[model samples]
Target: MKKAEDAQRLLRTLSTEMPEGWKKDYAGVRNEYRQAMEDAARQAALEINQTDPEVIEQFKKLRDDLFSSLSNHQARWPVLLLSEQRSVEYRQSVQAFEAKHSEFVRFMRQST
Candidate 1:
């Protein structure tokens, strides 16, 4: 949860500092993520092998948690930007988060 907050903070900072034109790019990327997640959920539904009620409940809880966090970040993206003082740091944070998220999505898709 702490890591998620840290990532959100960095994302807000970067979003504020970004040029106005980049908002369109951001929207595009966000849409891609949305599509990927939708596909992942569909795949998970089709591929989930466990028949036990307990394990299925656990999986649903975990999936809900992940989707909630990601949705929070996406929801906050419309807020205005900050200055460039910490731009480098925030950019690095965003990149790290993106890499981690992409890997998580890939793993989830494969595991499902």
Candidate 2:
């Protein structure tokens, strides 16, 4: 969860503080964010120890949703630095990702 939050912050910084040569910088940020998310997901998998099958399934679904949200946000990166329209779309994608992340966090807290 901390890793995911850090990745989210990194992405927000990348979007808002783009340097002059943004394309090159974006690639590095993108890689970092991807690695962070992967780490977070792995940690989440290891941490979930619910005995109930249904609860386990719920956790799995939430984890999948979180990753799917991250993927959707990542898909917007290339076009995100291109134009105002793309920027708007990118913002929307970020909002969607954050929503999923919040949902995951809430569920995790409840389960724990």
Candidate 3:
């Protein structure tokens, strides 16, 4: 019961902090990529004719490009986190924290 309560507390703290940490850690690059993607999506939406197959393909391409850009932006975080020299003793713990927090995040996203 005590362990369960501790785990629950940890989950709540982690679920909030992890995303905040990620935003703080990568806000500049992430926001830049997001802004670019949103701008391009908006422009494409205005010009795209959904009924035409060629236009539809172009929209798909735009989406893929956005995803690729975001993916590249996001993929840098783990490497940075792992190699961070400030906490040399806690690298394994950091990895574990990432895994656990990721699971919590995934569950929250799926549930909501």
Model 2, 1-112: lDDT tens digits are: 5665676676666567665776566677667766776776666666777567887899889989988877766665663455434556666777888888788878776776
Q: Between candidates 2 and 3, which one is better according to TM-score?
A: 2
Instruction: For each candidate, give its TM-score against the true structure.
Output: 0.55, 0.74, 0.36
**What's the count of clashing pairs in each model shown?**
2, 0, 0
Q: Put down candidate 3 lDDT per residue, 1-112, tens digits, no spaces.
A: 2332344355334434565454344444334534654554555565556577765665566455545533543464432453324354454444554454344333323322
Residue 85 in candidate 1, Cα distance off native in Å: 5.3
lDDT of 2 at 47: 70
The C-alpha stretches of model 3 lying farther than 4 A from their native spots are: 1-26, 76-112
For 5-25, candidate 1 gives per-residue lDDT tens digits of 344444454466686665565
Superior candidate under lDDT, 1 versus 2: 2
User: What's the candidate order when arranged by decreasing lDDT?
Assistant: 2, 1, 3
Model 2 clash pairs? none
Cα RMSD, each candidate = 7.7, 2.6, 15.3
Q: lDDT of each model, Cα atoms only?
A: 0.55, 0.71, 0.45
